[model samples]
Target: MTIWLHSEVGHNQDAKKEVKAFNSEDVFTTPKPERLLERILILATNPGDLVLDSFLGSGTTAAVAHKMGRRWIGIELGEHCHTHCIPRLRKVIDGEDPGGITKAVGWKGGGGFRYYRLGPSLIVKDEWGNPIINPEFNAAMLAEAMCKLEGFRYAPSEDIYWIHGKSTETDFIYVTTQFMSKQMLARLSDEVGSERSLLICCSAFRCDPSQFPNLTIKKIPKAVLQKCEWGHDDYSLEVKNLPAAPPTLEQEEPDDRPANSRRKSGKGKPRQASLFDMGGDQ
Candidate 1:
């Protein structure tokens, strides 16, 4: 014997009812019903399989996936990610949301999920074609991103700012936006010693490669300019029909400096890198 599943397992009204129970009002213009996701997951996946919802509107897919014993990932680009999805997921984890396929699926929730935000764009191009790091990035964030871009592990030294990361025990990477003179590079080469190598990324370096075979110098914005698209910053989908709003004080004249340089010039200590093992190509 064979069993056939109905294509229409849920209705829009059911989705509205589910959202209204938790949101107190119909905030979401359109939310997916948990039953629909349940049917789809049942057909396409098994317990412990991974499910991904890229545009997580009200997080119906994730909620259903969690209840169905599936590992899941959800991504939302708007503020609704925090305002709507997170609260809803919290309630789902605590078993407080009882309306959306909870009884049908025997979902008395007892699991949790983690939340993360994407960092600022790695590099942005100015009109002059110079590669400037995104103003939103901090020292640590920039260091970590550079490590990934250059094929190294982010491992900062507690006593050294230049030793931001390493590819091997003897090979390291240092990221800085300051101008580096030949004398400075020579000192760094001496510190690195003959056995190890150091890759220095700086805004300007007045030196020759022949002087220090163990030290490789790369100029910023120039070195990473051709790597990625630097013009298009916001990747989120926006409703084009909405009326344009006037810019606020903060938005009217945005600060283009890196996050750490908003106040005084070079105010605090630079951020030290941390250790993480991930693979990528330069």
Candidate 2:
């Protein structure tokens, strides 16, 4: 075992001086010396190893890790994440910061970092104690969230108004807060055509769902709620683990044979009908 003294690993005063080099106006309170982090990382990790600091108060661990050629993730819940961490990390990445283990590690910074802001919870309770989508979400955000909930890739089409997401090249999803009428459904069905399938998530709809063979209509909050389980003791499985939606049906030219007659493909094999094609002749 090697004894580490302030002379080698540095102390609290040294930490303050390091931070003052970049941000002297707002010095961080509880910062660990970069040399201290360097010693710990050198013993516990190697170059390119991932280091995680959940309580990143002054971003010292991440800064030292980056200089030492180690990958790092720093999580700070306080406002200092924006004030101190980001500013300090920026200097380190640009090779502008020359304090702490910089000279010792020969760190001429050449790396980058990405910052992500997590969104608020999707489900929130109303005054009536009913679960509803958080009103904080706008139209595009709500559509993207719905796409994630339904396991579809969130890629809205510029030309098509209803194409908010897609599970495949032929299967698509649409999300709306508007109440869907039968006439609107007819218009959507004509637009989607018989060649492809669409899943509609709306606030409300009037019409027998069976009327549209190519569309699967589900109400918004209800569909989202069904995908989430409440007050369950066993946490074994998640609702997101549910099976994927069925594939789109292959449309054929108007068949002259009876509806019940077996349709043969060009390869001389019987073609299987999708369960979603119930309204179409099987």
When superposed on Cα atoms, how far off is each prediction in RMSD?
13.8, 11.5
Instruction: For each candidate in the order shown, give its overall lDDT on alpha carbons.
Output: 0.72, 0.79
lDDT of 2 by residue, 162-222 (tens): 9998765566789998999999999998898866678899989999978887788888888
Clashes of each: 1, 0
Best by lDDT: 2
- Model 1 per-residue lDDT tens digits across residues 70-153: 867799998878777888888888899998789988989777776768876677767896567777878788777777666667
Candidate 2, lDDT over the whole model: 0.79
Distance from true location, Cα of 3 in model 2, Å: 4.7
